[model samples]
Target: MKIIVFLGPSLPRSEAASIIDAEFRSPVAQGDVYEATLIRPDAIAIIDGYFGFQPAVWHKEILWAMTQGIHVFGAASMGAWRAVELGPFGMVGHGWIYEAYRDGRLEGEDEVAITHGPAAVGYKPISEALVNMRRTFASAADAGVMTVDTARQLVQIAKRQFFPKRDYEAVITAAQLPAAQAADLSHWIRRHAIDQKRRDASSLLHWFSQNINYLSAPKRVAYQFSATVFWAQAVELKRREMLSRYPGRKLDHARIEQFTRQTMGNADVQCRQQRLEQCKP
Candidate 1:
C-alpha cells in the first residue's frame, strides 16, 4: 500500500491525530501530519478540505508532490483548483479550471475536455472536472450579463462548494445570486470552503495595508505554521520507517528538519512566482 499524508485545513488536534494515528505507526509521535520528513513512503495524498481556500499554499504542496513523483489528489476548494491547475500532476475535483488557466499553469491547446460529474469520488481524475468547470464558468459569466468582478467572484465562490455530482447546483445557485447577497453567503460557505476572492482583492489588500501587513505575510505565516506541523509528522514517519529498515537503529531529527526546510524553500520560491503570475493582467 502507498503511504499518503493528508495536509492543509487546520484540523482539530484531535481529528488530525485520529487520521495520522490510525494510519501511521505513531500518530502523535512528534506532533506532525506529513509523512515525508522521516519516511520515503511509496505514495502520499492530501485532503483538500484542509487547504482548499488558500490557493497559494495548496499549489506548493501539489507541485512538491508532483516533482517528487508522489501521487497527489485533492477534493474541494484548494483541491478543485489544483486538480485543474496541476492536472499535469494528475488530480481529482470539480470547478476552478478557468481560474487555473487564469493563473497560467493549466494549458491544453487541445480542447479535448471530459466530464464525469456522476462518478465515484476516487474514480474520476480531476482533469475531467476542470474541463467541465471551464464550460460552466464561461456560461455563468455570459449568462444574463454581469460585471467582470461579479463573474470573477462567482468563480471564486464556486471553488469551495463545487462537488462532482451532488453540490454543483448549489454552487451555481450561489454563483448566480446578486453580487451583494452572494458576498454575505460566502462567509457561510467558507466554513467548509475557501473563496477568498469573493471579497475584492483591493479591499482585502487595503485592510491588510492599513494594518501594516505585507501582502505575503498572512500566506507566509500560514505556510510556516502548517509546514512546521507537517515536518514534525514527517520526521516521526521517517524515524519509524528507518526502524523498520534497520531493526534497532535510532533515527536522526536534525537531518529531517534540514531536509524538510530545503524542500519547502524550493516550494516557496515556485509558489511565489505562481502568485505573481496570477496577479498579472
Candidate 2:
C-alpha cells in the first residue's frame, strides 16, 4: 500500500515527499480541508512547526482523512494534536503529548477541551506516558547518559518523526537577530516543553543559570565538534534548497547553515530534546 502525504498550503509536494522513502508517494496538493479531502490522501501529516503554531483549525482534516479510511501521523505542534485526534500516528520531535507524558504533568479533562474540545482520544493515559518519558530523559541528561549533543539529535529526530519539515525559520529583519535570537530560543524551548504554563521568569532565570554552568570548556568544546558534524550532515542532505520563498529579501544559505550549526550546540537544544522525550506520547 502507498502512503499519500498531504501537507498544508504553504508547503510544496516535493518538499513534503522528501521525508519518506518508498513508503511515500508523490504528494497531492491540498491547502485546506476542501482540497485535502479531494486528493483522497491515504494518510495525512500535519506539520506546522515552521509556522510556529499548531493548526488547530485543521482538526477536521484528520477526521475527514479518517472518514476516508486514511491514516494520520503528526509531529511537533500540529502532530501532537493530530496524534491525539488520529490514533496510531507517529510523532517526531517535541510535542505537547510528549511533554505531558514526560513530566508527570496532567491536565483534567476540562483543560484539554480548551484546545481540542472533548472528543475522547485516549489523551489522559498518553499524557502520563509522556511525563514518564520526560523523567527518563531528564535522568539521562543529569547522569550524562545522554550528552547535550545526543539530546539535540534526539530533538531533531523528534521533529522529523512527526513534523514534515526539515527546518524551521522566521522572517525577522537582519537587525533583529541580535535581540531576537535569545527570545526566539526561549520561545521555541517553551513551545516544545510540556510545562509551558510553568515557564515563568523564575524558570527562565534557573535555566540560564544551569546553562551557564554547562557551557564550560570541555562541554563547549564537545558541542562545537558535534555542531560541525551536524552541519556536515545537513549539507549532505541538501536542506538549504528546500526553501521556496523567504522574506526580508532572499534567504542566506551560509548564514542559515551557520545558525543551524550553532543551534545544534546550544544548551536549549538539550532542553528541547529532554523535554520532548519526556513529553512525547
Candidate 3:
C-alpha cells in the first residue's frame, strides 16, 4: 500500500515523489483528510493545503486519521499549521516551520500562506511566504550580506506587504538601505532566497521514508476521540461526498442503459394500468 501525501505548492509532485515513494495528492481542503482515511493508508504527510474562499482542512480530521491506525505527519505550509495544534495528540510535526509554531516563536497562518499558480503549472508560487522571509533574512545576517539590524529591517519590510503581493524584490526595495548595502543585499537575496516551505517539506519526506514502520505504533493521546456534534456533522458531510461520488460502485454504460429502460417500462405499465382502472364503468 502506498503512503498518502497531501501535497501542493511547497513540494512539487515530481520532486517530492522522487524523495519518498508515496502517493502525492493535491493540497488538502475542508474534507480531504477524512476522505483520505477511508482508504486506510499506512501513513499521511500533509505538506500544503488550501485557504480562503475554500474551506481549509479541519484539525479534527487529522486527529480522526491518527485514531484509525494511520500515522499522520505534517510540515511546511498548512501542514505546519495543523501539526502545531495537533502534535501533542500524535500528529507528527517536522522541520523548522513546525518547530517555530510549536515553540510559539512564529505565530500566524499568514506566515506560511502564499498565493500561487494552479496545479497545471505545479502551483508556481507567485508570492513569498513569511517563513521564507525569516529564513532569507537570517541567512543574510549570518553571511554578512547585511548586519543583524539590516536583516531585521528587511524582514519587517516584507511583513508590511500583503502576503499575496509579497516578493523579494518588492521587500528589498522597501528596505531602502544605502546604495552599497542595497546592492550587496540584493545580490545575496537573488542568490539565496531560500524556500523554507520546500526545505521543511523535504525534511518531512526524508523522515517519512526512514520511519515507515511507525504507522503500526500505538498513539498515547491524553484522551480518546469523541464523536462530538461538530465532528459528526463533518463526517456526515464527508459521507455524503463519498456517496455522491459513487466510490467503489461501478456500472458500465450498457448496464446503466438497460436499467434505465427497464425502469421507464415499469413506469409506463403502471401509468396505463391506473388509467384503465379509472376509466372502468
Candidate 4:
C-alpha cells in the first residue's frame, strides 16, 4: 500500500522512513491532502502540520480521502487535533496526545505547538511544546525532582504565555519565583524533560509499520461522501485537474491561469476606472 505521511519537527524524515517506510512530506498545509489524493495513495498519516505561520491542512480533504478509500491516521501536533475532530468519519487517532484531546483533558493547540526552523535546518524546534513540558513536569514530580503542586503551577504558567514564546525558561521567568528556586527547577527540567511529541510521533510510525496491510482496507462508513462547491474549487486549485476547453485534455493550474489571463485581456476587459475614482484608500 502506498502510505504518504505529512511530517516535520516531531521526527526527522530519515528516522521516520526507517520506521514507517512511507513517503515523508513536509508539515502539511492547505491543499496537501488534496494533492496527496492525486497520487492515489492507499493511506495518509499526519504527524505534524502548519498553522498561524501558514495555512493548515483542510478537514474536507481528509474526509474526501477517506471516501476515496484512503485510510487516514493522525497523531502528534496538529495532526492529533484533526483526528479528534474527524474520528467519527473513520479517521484513526494514535498516541497519548490524541487520547488527551479526545477525552477533553487537553483543549489548547499550543499544548502541542512549537516554533521551529525551516526544512533546510531539519525544522529544529525553537520553542518547547506545552505537551512536552507538562509531561516533563509530571515525570519530575514522580521522580521527586519537584513537588506536584510546583509542577502544576509550572504547567499553568507555560500555558499563559503565547504559544510561540512558551519555552521552559520563559515559563520559569514569568512565574517570578525566587532565583534559587527557579535555577533548581530549570536544572531539574534540563535533566528530566520528556519529549511527548517525539514519543507520540514514534508511536505513529511503529503503528503504521505493523498495520500497513490493514490500513489500506476500504472504509465501511454510514455516511456517503458530499462534494460541496468549495471542496470542488479546492481540489481543482490544488490538483489542477480542470478539464480543458479541448476535449479529453486536462490543463494544470498554471496553464488554466495563463488561458484565463489571455482570454480576459483579449476579450475587452473593464478597467473599473469609475469605481476606482470614487473609492477611498
**lDDT agreement with native, every candidate:** 0.39, 0.34, 0.79, 0.79
Instruction: Arrange candidates, best lDDT first.
Output: 4, 3, 1, 2
| Segments in model 4 whose C-alpha atoms lie over 4 Å from true places | 240-281
Q: Order the candidates by TM-score, highest first — what do you get?
A: 3, 4, 1, 2
Return the TM-score for each candidate structure.
0.30, 0.29, 0.83, 0.83
- For residue 167, model 3's alpha carbon misses the true position, in angstroms, by 0.7
Candidate 3 ranges beyond 4 A from true positions = 218-222, 243-281
Model 4 gets an lDDT of 0.79
Model 3 agreement with the true structure over 157-232: per-residue lDDT tens digits: 8887899999888887787777888788778888888999999999989887787676556544565665444554
**What TM-score does structure 3 among the candidates reach?**
0.83
Write candidate 2's Cα lDDT for 1-119 as tens digits. 33333232212334334434213322222234323434444444443222223223344334434544444544323344445543432222234443453344543222222121111
Candidate 4 or 2, higher TM-score: 4
- Of candidates 4 and 1, the better by TM-score: 4
Q: Which ten residues in a row have the lowest lDDT in candidate 3?
A: 255-264
Clashing residue pairs in candidate 3 (N, C-alpha, C atoms within 3 angstroms):
none
Q: Which of the predicted structures, 1 or 3, would earn the higher TM-score when compared with the native?
A: 3
lDDT of 4 at 67: 69
Task: Give lDDT tens digits, candidate 1, residues 50-155.
Answer: 2222213335444444444444444323334445665554543323433454467455422222222221232133332333344444554455334456655655
